[model samples]
Target: MGTTSNSSLRSAGSITDVAGIEVGHFTDTRRPTGCSVVIVRDAAVAGVDVRGAAPGTRETDLLSPTNLVDRVHAVLLAGGSAWGLDAAGGVMRWLEAQGVGMEVGLAKLPLVPAAVLFDLFLGDSTIRPDAAAGYAACEAASVHAPAQGCVGAGAGAAIGKVFGIDRAMKGGIGTASVTVDGVTVGALVACNALGDVIDPDTGRVIAGSRTPDGKSLFDTRRSLLRGEAPKPLITGTNTTIGVVATDAVITKAQATRVATMSHDGLARSINPVHTMSDGDTMFALGTGKSGKTLGMMTLGTMAAEVTAMAVVRAIRAARGVTAGGLYLPAVSDL
Candidate 1:
């Protein structure tokens, strides 16, 4: 929704439309965990923001504007909590083989920043994503919209844990993109929140904790404000990670600002987000391949919108997960 000469309000439908971007997902259903790799054939300036108190991240320090690294080769979002961080190593291995990344004396160290969401509780906690899983994701990379919903890092994703796992809803990966005035902005999100997912346009709950009967929806915010019985919380079991890509030419600092503003999209679509137990993080990447037709302010605003839409898409596209006698239904199932 920026000032575009084209005046069209539609996108090419996925992040790949941004050009030079490829998305890949490697899902290990046996472990009920996987990783998603966002590959940029051409180096792209990157920035990140970690809002949650508990986060498992790798190579984030290098993303700083003051850091020597100006661009990133890929970003990995995976399941398996802290142990899943190993997946990043696999991505690095693949990139190095392809001759991508900052060149060192004898080797090119691929700069891949990664974040993990807790999904151990959803499947076999003992089986976690590892280096092999990361390499598989890179090998599976494609230029089209990656598979969404209960696949990739979202495989074990679950939402509305405020009332415990029994009442939680299925969470997964989703994507949305918009092209305006020849500038395209897109977002891909792995939604696994500790609160309810809302439809911002309608202001109605789409998914969240349910009553004991698993029939009526429970309002997590109202219950907290009313001082009802304290809901049990499983610390370090939730988080949401995502990426925002644009063709606009922007600096690392500006990319950081875009990441900051994009959090507004999470707030708009999720109630009671960024809690202590969640490790919510987002990354902003700029390809700088297109002319700067829109101001930074306009691009930032549109990024937020794209992110919010991606959140809604995540919930809508999610598929039910059932393993070890635990059943979590996607929004459509309900």
Candidate 2:
């Protein structure tokens, strides 16, 4: 990647910093589960990687390089596990109303791919994201920088579940951007992990499992060193879903590679990530606005780097939430 000053990177702001993208979220704070949508005002070449063993995804197969649909109109990340997939319907409706989609003989089909994280247990599972919520988010879509932490799909997100819900910390959405040689890459993450959250720059646990009394730190990596199984007071309730976008022109295959590489950020920040119980997934989008100022390899590398930054930012920006009789601490508490 071409050299970019730290100040420039810091000033790049959220994923919307990439031209032609609009983001919005519809949250039900009372239920603590919601949905987020990234509306590509201009359709973008997209690719995805689903690393977690139990992922709840929609239309991901169509994103393959060999597939017919090379560009996507929107990508959604939401809470409520598989049930949240319904939110995509609302996105489709919104796009269709705007007359943005693939042309068929009589009508247009909006291409929207979505991923869902398990947040049902965090609040009232009965109240989950639906088509109404999705449409609401789209109506609220704007190029304005997105709000991070404890918002959108991450409203009920939590991390460091290796010890259990009681010890887990709160996690939410975060965004970061870096511009190199005119090419801008940005990332947005909803971090609800099965492992501890570490600040990659500091190599320290910033927010994660804590002692029962909530006075001391608990490192999940150390527990794994002993090769012991963890008995989570709550199980099968975590995932980290995110999007990485760039203005550089790149092919769908290259975007797929970028998506694969972006997972490095998750590995760096989340210990024991992509676990069987988690549904970790990422999407890469190339808007082709800046030509090819950055090489594919360099762009992919920066995608990973910014992804890590976004992860730390998510933890730092997150605020704690108490639901279902459990208290999840935020990074500020640490």
Candidate 1 Cα misplacement greater than 4 A, ranges: 1-12
TM-score of 2: 0.95
Tens-digit lDDT string for candidate 2 (126-165):
8899998899889989989889888888887888888777
lDDT of 2 at 238: 87
lDDT of 1 by residue, 1-334 (tens): 3234444433437777777788889899685688898988677899999998889899888888898877999999999999999999999999989999887888877989999999877757888889999999999998777778888898888998897888888999888788776787788889889988888778788999888898777878787788856466778789999999898888998888888888998998888899998999999989887766567877887788878888888888887878767888888877
Judged by lDDT, which candidate is best?
Answer: 2
- After superposition, which runs of candidate 2 have C-alpha atoms over 4 Å from their true positions? 1-12, 232-236
Error of 1 at 128 (Å): 1.5
- Evaluate model 1: give its lDDT: 0.85
lDDT of 1 at 32: 68
lDDT of each: 0.85, 0.86
